[model samples]
Target: MLQTYAMVVNRNKNRTKLSTSSVEKNINVVNTVKNPSNENINKMEQSKKPAKRIIGTKIMEHVKLQPDKIIMKKKVFCLSNVKKCHRDDVVEFLQSSGINVITCFPVIKRTDENDPKAINNDEHSTMFRVCVEKKDEGKMKDPEVMLQHIIVREWKFNEKKLDFKNG
Candidate 1:
């Protein structure tokens, strides 16, 4: 069996590495555990690891946890009307006019908002990611392109949506 180490804290708040037994000394203990369950270990490890992202849900089959988050590459995409095949129009219009189009700029989570409060706190945050596939992509980046093409409305998306259960 593999042994796990626990840390002990002193009155001065200094962390000291000690053996499993140190109670007679009247020392303060933090995370004092002889053996923790595998689940606890996993939670501790996951906190240290960065958030994992996946392109499509199909890739989630390899792991027990489904990768609910989405990730997009360096392509610029425009989502217009569904009837217009929003995917193709945005890519086409941009490239035809010259803006270094990537075509099919997959709708992934936008990294603009580092904190979650920015979305929920706002009074008028009209579901961005929901219509991301039908929103403006390069408008935020390139103003000149959108300025000229005023006739066509562009859709933009931000943030990834998560699923949760409620009673």
Candidate 2:
């Protein structure tokens, strides 16, 4: 009976050793599959990603291509009290006053119902919408101070001009 008990203990020890070695071999195989050499990892990283294009870099390239053209921002303005002011005369006047006016045209109102400040149905006064370069925006305010019987108001983008009273 003692000999039989010793044989059972020896069999358990051998089974434990076999299981531990099998576990170690599995761990080594998994590590080798998951992580390759450092040189292989670098090559895989390079092949996986393509070269990226930056937006600012592309814009700069176009800007660099045009050397002669001066990039100027556009600004809009509302010129009021243009009762007898001709479009050509106004353009010439603005240009002469150091205001670089790109374009100016009369803003004709179809009806007085839209405008609350309209005194009467026939009280639609001649107004002009003017567009100029951003650098010449300061010149728009000058027309109000320099010219008589004319109101100059800077029009903001995507915003409605509420005040239409001649100042």
Candidate 3:
């Protein structure tokens, strides 16, 4: 009776090992089917490349069709009375105040000889040309209101005229 019991225990252990091995093989086959190999993944990525290229080309074509619309979206403004500040200092000050200055230069205004306030020397002032986006153009129209710290003598929006020559 003792021998028969020992033989039964050994048989159960062997059966358990065989079943576990078969289960591991089945799991490997399922994983392979669900997750593709590297080569298959590469092929799928290559197939998606052309679709992305087509989308990029469509965007470029749309931009080319309406070039004037893009030009109208941005406005240029000339800011005067920069207080004879250096070019770098003016740019840094404007940048600190959240103003995007495109170009800056010192402008010498000719003084009128007849005017009582006119000086003998040329009046030097720094001028800044800034490109403002359409969304912010309205707010930036009044430099005195927008830039409270800076002394603004004059502010004006630059007008751009399109000239087309007919052959």
Predicted structure with the largest lDDT when compared to the true one: 2
Q: Which runs in model 1 stand beyond 4 Å of their true positions?
A: 1-21, 24-27, 30-47, 50-86, 103-140, 147-167
lDDT by residue (1-167, candidate 1, tens digit) is: 99999987666656676665667444333333546668878988789688886555354346677646645444333332233223445546556655444334333235736655444422233221112222334453465765443333344446756454631
lDDT tens per residue, model 2, 6-99: 4344566555344458779998889877988798788877986878844332345545465455556789999887775567777787888888
lDDT of 2 at 79: 89
Which 10 successive residues of model 2 have the least lDDT summed? 53-62
Q: Write down the lDDT of every candidate, Cα atoms only.
A: 0.45, 0.71, 0.56
By lDDT, is 2 or 3 better?
A: 2
Task: Give lDDT: candidate 1, residue 155.
Answer: 47
Top TM-score hit: 2
Q: What are the models' TM-scores?
A: 0.28, 0.44, 0.33
User: Which scores higher on TM-score, 1 or 2?
Assistant: 2
